[model samples]
Target chain A: MNEPILQVNDLHYYYNDNQAALNGISVSIYPGERIAVIGSNGAGKSTFFLNINGVLSPEHGEIFYHGTKITKKSLPELRKNIGIVFQDADNQIIASSVKAEISFGPMNLKLPREEVSRRVNMAMEYMNITEYGDRPPHYLSGGEKKRVAIADIIAMEPDVIIFDEPTAALDPLNAVMLEEVLEKLSAEQKTLLISTHDVDFAYRWAERVLVFCDGQIIADGTPLSVFQNDEVVKKASLTRPVMLDVYEELVRNGLLADAGVYPRDMREFRELIGK
Target chain B: MSHEHTARSHTGRHHHHKGGHRHDTGGSSIDFYACHSRIRHWNPGFRVGFSIILLLFCILANHPAVSCVIILTAAWITVGMGGLSFRRYFSVLTIPITFILLGSAAVAVDFSRQPIGDFHLYLFWGYLYLTYESLLNTLFLILKVFGAVSAMFIMTLSTPSHELFSVLRKARCPSLIVELMHMIYRYIFILMEVQRNMRISAESRLGFGDFKTSCYSFGQIASNLFIIALKKANAYYDAMEARCYDGTFAFLEEEHQANPKHLIAAGIYLTALMSFWLAIR
Candidate 1:
């Protein structure tokens, strides 16, 4: 709507033997939009994210950031603007110490020492891990490591952040913490694009949903609309969120006169059902 | 949850060791292992200085008594201050002693000329005459190596690896070498774990039926491990790049400080080493 910050056109990718990983996929993301790309395993969701960050190039497609086509020549500049967080926190952390890991991104930009120190402190504070600043990353708890990894990228101040299954290995509590962080990042006007199999996470955090099935986008809309479409959900090999399923079942049984349902959480679902 | 709990326990143990000084306010209840862990308190400059001093001593002095005294002092410091157990101390000396024995055997068999006055038959292998003089010379050689190795280990066991790297960095060690050292240290355990997994997998597959097959399986496992390590390294590098990491390296803090007691002990060790060298000469 307001000068799309990212545009992917006719993207086609493959892993091996020309088996299409992404088939003519097109998506546009604006600044400050929380978009979730949901799909089952081997559905090319991760491949799409990789192509967006220039980590993996599509055989036939064009990716543009701010109307400028991203090329090998401009990848370094593009990457500086788009930070991708890998799923594994262990793989993302490069430095032995927490402080050094956070400072790594700022130092890569070749910022002055004072500015680097300031940004490191700011990023640590943002992640609520100032005390862990002196601790080794390997020694920190998994949640703490994940926070430090996020802080490492946050220090870079990327305009667009990509997370690949951020909550895949996290406990419910840690997953909620991750969602809060993502919400905060989105609030800061950072374009957040996450690829996840967790429908609940997608439904809770994403304003727009992209459902990938057999290396193609079958549905793209608000989370509620996407989940309500049984055909699309079945095709994508995805299940509706529990609350959404319950609401649909209630509507099917003619228990609710109105089918339109929007409940933020389980408690809200109970209240809505009572009404 | 158990894994997380164990990881937390390990972290807690390290933190406890790190914060041991704060609770031990009495100053009399000193734990040498805790003291060794606080080798971070030692000055990087001093570590480098003493390392250079030891290097020079090794090059300039060769007397058996001097080397013996140096070796003995290093062993004492490692055992008393570094908190290395007797078994570990002996284990560290074992390889050098073995090499010395082999060298002495070679000298006895090859050289007919007597280097020292004492000539007693230590071992007789047909025409191979193993003399006591040659044995003593071998022991001296072993002691010299022991002194140098023990000195280096004392520095390492007392000082944290990160501080040791800092000392190396300040000594104008090549950035590439320092980085490689850091990376190797960080990933060696990972590689070892990978190797162990491969071994376990191979064993599980019953690939070790005969000697030849076992060797073949071992080679396959090694090759597979190498490939996996390379893939992991590449993935790790990509992950690092995603986090905006560049070539320059930074550390948490310059933890190594100059403690007066450590310096005094180091000074005493150096003085004793020099006096022994002079006395022997």
Candidate 2:
């Protein structure tokens, strides 16, 4: 579409024992696109994110950012534009206080003091954690720590933000808050790639979906297209999103017209049902 | 969400979690107190400086009066100004006091085949003797240690580790040490939580049904924790790398205004302690 912000070509990664974590993986991630990556455990989702974020080097093939090859010399520059929100907020938080943790990414960029402070304040305010600026991370609840972790990445103002199961340990209220944050980020036109097992969330939130299976991209397309592929669904052992199942059942019963498009969320489902 | 440390009851949070470890068994309580300490808002640099100076005075002066005054002053500052309960202060000190008692025993009590000191007791193997001079020296050493440690406690109890790290940064402490401290401080609680959960799970499974089983379970837990720590270390580095880390460290420091009254009070207290030491000497 718009000169893919990130392009991975036949990427391969191996662990210490020579086991392939990623094998022949290739994808082009467009700027400002909301992409959800779904896979079973040990499916190389985290490794893929690490590779794209330039934390892990691919043993084969190459990755490019804005058409430039990602080399050892370009990693620092690439990292400045692509941030990863790790699954464990505790491990991701490197600073003692919430403000310090948020400022860490910006400070690593070697920005001016004023700009760093300004970004820290803005990120805190955006995450609604401005009051926790002086509080240490150990005392914050799991949800609050998650917010601070997101703020840590947001402060860097990265173009592509990768979240590794951002909602894993989060309670229901926190999940809602996280969704709102994703919506805000999407509105800001930031490219967001989230790896999660929550098929319903992926179905509802993502404009495009990537199903990672055994370190390879088994399916990649709009959520509807990818989810409708029965072979891919069965191969990946993915459960159909509740909304998708209900929508298809209604169409089968002739209670609703086969509108030729699936609803992404509750609002769209309601609109489709004309109720 | 209140997220207010002061509003949260401390009694319910710490005791159940800590395992039987000698290294600050009161770790969480200390953290809670430091985070909520009323005087924490004071400039950490000033607090650190004051504590160091007070500690030096107590050790170098070596006068019983000076040590006593320091112990009193530290207790007063910790309990009175910092809003820590008197019972909590003593409870934290209990471990150190017990350690001191055990340590000074060798000096305070001596055994000889023949009775030597004015105070001697007959034992089947030998004679247990206590010399007044040695007993007095041991007493003075105990008091000096308590005074010095109390001075340190005043600083640590009032300032959180992050604030202390910020002060260290200002003091030009090596970035590597400070950065390591920052990471270690952040992970200690996480690791502790993980270990605590594992222990509870093991207990539920009767992994520690007997002494032998307890030893086996402890070994298993230790090995698992080691593996987890290694994995966590790699993940932490990856997370840091994603943030554009290039071996450079920068931490945001909250600016704290120094209260001149606190400085003046410290000066007056030090001056008063010096005079008391001189008079006693």
Candidate 3:
């Protein structure tokens, strides 16, 4: 069995003036797991990620990071391990320049200056943002700012990085760039938890998908199983990835062969169709 | 994806100290070059100290020659040693010149019922006149102000604002003020971006389509922007908290080894400036 890096046991959270955001949520995240969290708006994905990141203390239940229960004393350690790239880069970016912004997370870890510089350089080079090092982050393009936000987490060299709606406001070209960056990070064996409503993105990128509906995990399985389950799709308010839907339609019409394998992404789907 | 600043947006450019100074374009220009400066990582203490001493010399010296020397030296360091463009250097000086010209007008000509002892007299019911002393003082003040402004601009043109704030903190400046300065520097850009987007959206909706409507729409946008800005403030706080910010300074500052050669050069310049001041006084 894969060792769980993050575990939530009956985790519950409620806003002071609103309904329960995470109602008894429990999930175990294995090391290096590429988990895509899918949910409609107000369906508790953000709340769950926040709890795991130690941004919010759950009203009830427990969250364990690397088998250690996350308490106030352990919150800092948990944060160092679980970095979050917020939906809006403008919000996550607090430093004036790109270098300072990326250096922030490492400095927060209280790392030595030399180590911080090395990590900052590595992350910037990884994200292809070395040119923007001294430029004010506020003046950067949306796509550039997003890269800096990701680099901010990468500089910390976190064990797991959570991206909330990573491609929400990104244009198609920049969106592709972001996915490539995520792919590179994943290849390095860093666990990734991305909460997004982009089904095509989730389908192509994620190995495991967790469907959330009304503050509960309605379905959790391989993308094919969870997304193809009609009841789960309806409950989660998610449409199937376009490629998946089209591939299945072709097979249903006897125009294509399944080959006993579900297509994982667009390239695979095309291969399955023999086109 | 379009990283361009929207045209004619009502950002902090029009609201902050020194009107029409844009946080996006104007401030970023200095910040851009400052970051790219060849000696950007030089100890800010030497830079700040040199600038301040030059500024004081410009004030204390009796002759405009001293101010002229100080101004020339500031321009040389910023444009030569720092590698800032000569065009940009000239352009930055224009800012202080505008105010200095406006202010010097008061001293250049005086109004009096009996016509003050004079260089020139013009009738404005009674008389407007100028004296040799007042004229000299006015010219001297303008030169002094320009010299001081140039000296300070050397620091601003070479050192990024955050680094300057970092230098202040190292000098045992109040943490609250330094932190506030840092946050304000960051949020100004945020607010400016919000302003740009709001402007573009408004313009798309015929907000600035006509003369009267444009005025009305601007007022509405301003009010709406205030409310939204407040909401963004709350969001910013939450975002800060997520990053494990504990109401403390959490950013990294560059640690540069103070250059002994630069310090020695600064000392030489200080002596030259003092000798100039004494000779002129």
Which sections of candidate 3 miss by over 4 Å? Answer: A16-18, A270-275, B6-29, B36-41, B81-87, B119-126, B209-215, B277-281
Listed per candidate, the RMSD to the true structure in angstroms reads 6.7, 3.2, 4.0
* Alpha-carbon shift of residue B185 in model 3 (angstroms): 0.1
Summarize candidate 3's per-residue lDDT along A1-275 as a digit string, tens digits: 86699988998889864888888888899998899999999999988887888878899999888888888998888877888888988778887778888887777677888898999999999899998787777557788888998898888888999999999999899888988988888898999999999998888889999998888888888888888899999878799998788778878998887665777676786676665
TM-score of 2: 0.92
TM-scores of chain B, in order:
0.73, 0.89, 0.86
- Please say which candidate is ahead in lDDT: 2 or 3: 2
Q: In terms of DockQ, which candidate is strongest?
A: 2
After the best TM-score superposition of candidate 3, give how far the Cα of residue B183 lies from its true spot, in angstroms. Answer: 0.7
lDDT of 2 by residue, A1-275 (tens): 57999999999999865678998999999999999999899889999999988888888989999999988898888999998998988788888888888989998999998999999999999999998888778788878889999999999999999999997988899999999999999999999999999999999999999999998999999888889999999989999999999989999999888868788789998887775
**Comparing to the true complex, what docking class would candidate 2 get?**
medium
Clashing pairs in 3: none
- Could you tell me every candidate's TM-score relative to the true structure? 0.79, 0.92, 0.89
**Per-residue C-alpha lDDT of model 1 across residues B199-233, encoded as one tens digit per residue:** 76788998888999899998998899889888889
DockQ of 1: 0.38
Q: Against the true structure, candidate 1 has what lDDT?
A: 0.73
Model 1 clashing residue pairs (backbone)? B40-B256, B41-B257
Kindly indicate the candidate among 1 and 2 with the higher DockQ: 2
lDDT of all predictions: 0.73, 0.88, 0.81
Quote the positional error of residue A211 for candidate 1 in Å.
Answer: 1.6
